[model samples]
Target: MRIRVDDLSGEATRSLIAHHLADMRATSPEESCHALDVDALREPAVTFWSAWDGDDLAGIAALKDLGAARGELKSMRVADAHRGRGVGRALLHHVMGAARARGLSTLWLETGTPPAFLAARRLYADEGFTECGPFGDYVNDPFSVFMMRLL
Candidate 1:
């Protein structure tokens, strides 16, 4: 698989992001859904990436520079066809390495607590992320699980 920075312009990337957003909304309450849309992911502070397998998109992920030596992981999704193929882990390690290279000391993320999100939560835990209180603009929400990892 080839992992590269994405400008959020390709049809496959846009479609995947749309699917991710829709899935998040369908799985969680509107108020508890924090997934970003295409425009939001295009923000200057965020860097998006797409993992590709030949002509197919394998997955997508993003890293947000939170300033002050901290960063946030966002929009991590492994395409259905690529699940269990290490795409998620590869994207995660790529983002983590980018954060560390940027001199960030920590990484943060917010995911849902529903059964549908079990794999994601487990992946984070396995990667050394531990539960934490809400950070940044987030507030307490029973449906949201916040996690943090030192880089």
Candidate 2:
């Protein structure tokens, strides 16, 4: 699979990102969903990446600089057809590498607390991310599950 930093300008990448945001909105209340839209993910501090297999889009993920030696992982999503096929893991590993390449000493992420996110939480845990309090501009919210790892 080819994983490249994306500018969110391609039709396929944008559609997949929109799908990810829509799912996040559907799973969590508006105030609690922290998933970024394509345009938001394109901010100067953020680096978005899309994974592809030949001509097909497999997944997408992003990393946002949070100042200090910190970075935040954002918008990780594997296509429904690509779920459980190591897409999320591969995308996450790629993001972590990017974070390290940028000299980040810590990486954090915010995910939902619902049962729909159990597998996601497990994935983070398996990657050595421990549960943590809200970082950055995030507040304390029971619906939010925050995780972080030192690079």
State which candidate has the highest TM-score.
1
Runs in model 1 lying further than 4 Å from the true structure: none
On a 0 to 100 scale, what is the lDDT of residue 54 in model 2? 89
Lowest summed lDDT over 10 consecutive residues: which window, candidate 1? 18-27
TM-score of each: 0.99, 0.97
Q: Which stretches of model 2 miss by more than 4 angstroms?
A: none
Deviation in Å, model 2, residue 116 alpha carbon: 1.3
Global lDDT for candidate 1?
Answer: 0.96
Candidate 2 — what's its lDDT?
Answer: 0.92
What's model 1's TM-score?
A: 0.99
Deviation (Å) of 11 in candidate 2: 1.3
